[model samples]
Each structure stands twice: as structure tokens, then as C-alpha cells.
Target: MAYLLSSERPAVAAASRNPLLAILRWAAKLRAERHQRLAFREMLEFDEARLEDLGLTRNDVLEAMGASAPQAGLHLQRRRALRSAIWLGRSSF
Candidate 1:
């Protein structure tokens, strides 16, 4: 039957019968999430002066690591505004 030959048919049939494959996929996803969390932790360990030298604040790093998309967008806008204001102030002196 044409239904049996459809591209979508084999993958679903194979996945349902293959428990090991499902487990491997889950493990890989978990590993990637752990790696991201560890990297965020290392960034947080940096001191304030060091973070400032990188043009980032603690809040910025934390938001980038864990916040939702909307929250991150707000933070980005606020950061840009602050930088613009600071630059204007410095130039006026």
C-alpha cells in the first residue's frame, strides 16, 4: 500500500519499537543542558570589575543564561539605553 511507503511511516514505527534509541536521545539532550548550566555558572564566578571590563553586568549574564525571551529583550533594550546615556555624558565633559 502507498501508506506503508510514506516517509513519515518508517520513523514513527522505528521509534516506537526502539527503546534504546529513545533513551540515547534523552541522554544527549540532558548532557547539552548540563553543559549550558555549567558555562553559566563559570561566568557568574567572575568578579564585578572583571564583568564590567567585559561590558556586562551580573544581571545581564544571569538574564542571558536563564530568563525568558521577552525578559531578555527588555534587558537588552535597557542595557543599550544605559550605555548610550553613559557615552553621551562622558562626551559632554
Candidate 2:
């Protein structure tokens, strides 16, 4: 493990205890989560033909949004990958 010099240690400790820094970090997290939700909303707006072009159904989007984590896009990607794997397995038969 890397050890911080005494001077650097004090600065790091002070930063961690800073209330403003904590709030800023919290606000940034909220903003990032909001952006993720907005992106999903935009995806939901796409018509069936457009969604089909993207290789995803409206149900896929809904399922992704239903995930407890804020990363709906990650869920969608996982779902798409699972579907692709299933299709590939069927084709190999």
C-alpha cells in the first residue's frame, strides 16, 4: 500500500471531513442518476419501428427501467446480450 506523506495526509483528511465537498458529491450523484433516467425516457419515446431498428422492444426498455439500479442502459445492454445468446444457441441447433 502507498503511504501518504504527513502533509498530504492532513489535506486528504480535511477534504473528507468537509461538508461542502460531501454535498457537492451528493448533488453530482443525483445529477448523473437524473441524466440516466432522462435517456431512458427518450428511448421510451421511440416508435416501435425505430425501436425494432435498434434491436430492442418496448418491453426491454420497461424491464430495464424496472431494475433497482440507476443504470438502466447497462441493464438494456445485458438483456440484449442475453437475447442474442439465446438466438445464437437456437440457430446452432
Candidate 3:
């Protein structure tokens, strides 16, 4: 009787049946964020010119580096995407 068109409907239903499954998913997500954060931290080694070439500034990297892993990744990604859309002329964004 419950017709669902969303792709995640099954996942949501399964998650309700097994609470620990949700915890494991959360842990996996955190681990992924940690890895992404480390990669972003490495960007700090780039000089201002190099960062600028990538459409990022030292302050942007510094700001992302200061946040939590997930937030930092989202912040950097969002900034880069915006830069690409505006500066790089990626109209598809």
C-alpha cells in the first residue's frame, strides 16, 4: 500500500529495522570525511599563486582547514564549485 518512488525509500525502511546499521553508516561517513579532510589539509602547501590558479585563496583553504571534517569538505567543495561556475565559466553548474 506504501508506494515510494524515491531511491532511498528502501534504505530508510531497512534502517528502521536495524538501528546499528545506521551507526555503522555514520561511522563510515565519518571515516570518509576524515580522509577528505586530510587531502584538503595538504592543499595548504600550495603557494598563493598555485592556489589562485585553482580558483582558491589562502584564506579559503585556511577557513576550510579550521572547520570539522565534514564541514571543511563541504565548504571547500562549495567554494570550488562556485569559483568554477563564476570564474572558470563553467555554465553547466
Candidate 4:
């Protein structure tokens, strides 16, 4: 997974130029936010096979969908940490 960090001031100013795009972006963000919450709540019960049927790996779908920077940032960090932990565990073993 890749982590993207936009320069905050420029990013906001650029987004402010297009009202319609901004609204559409907001709607997409809302949808993704809802999905993330649902995913967390149902984490144990989630099915990877079904996600593939929907034509998406969880990460691909997430990047396509949209998310607030804070939420996305937290997720990125968590994923990085988990990957690091896995590597460390393998080395220890």
C-alpha cells in the first residue's frame, strides 16, 4: 500500500476552485467513511472472497472510493505498522 500526503494549504485551495467536483468528492468521502466504519465493526465476519467478486482488493476499493485525509492517514499508518511487525516476527522466528 502507498501513502500519499498532499500539502494541506495548496490542496484545499485547489479543491475550492470547483464546487461541483467538491460536492461530488464530499459525497464519495461520506460513502467511504460509512464503509470503513462498517468494515471495522464487521472485521471478523468480513469475507475477502466476496470483495474479490466485487472486483476489488480491500485497498483498491478503498483508494477508489474516497476518504477523509485523517481517516486514510490512520489506516495507512496502521497497515505500515502491521507489515513491519510481520517482517520483524519472521526475522525473529
lDDT of 1 by residue, 53-81 (tens): 65668887788677653465466456656
Q: What would the per-residue lDDT of candidate 3 be over residues 43-89, giving only the tens digit for each residue?
A: 87888889978878878888987887658867877878888888767
Quote each prediction's TM-score: 0.49, 0.65, 0.55, 0.40
**Candidate 3, backbone clash total:** 0
Better of 1 and 4 by lDDT: 1
User: Lowest-scoring 10 consecutive residues by lDDT in candidate 1?
Assistant: 68-77
- Worst lDDT run of 10 residues, candidate 3, spans 8-17
Highest TM-score: which candidate?
Answer: 2
Give the Å shift of residue 5 in candidate 2: 22
Candidate 4 lDDT over residue span 12-69, tens digit each:
4566677898899999989877877676445424578864443334674365336564
Model 2 bad stretches (over 4 Å): 1-15, 87-93
Q: After superposition, how far is residue 71 of candidate 3 from its true place, in Å?
A: 5.2
lDDT of 3 at 53: 82
**Candidate no. 1 TM-score:** 0.49
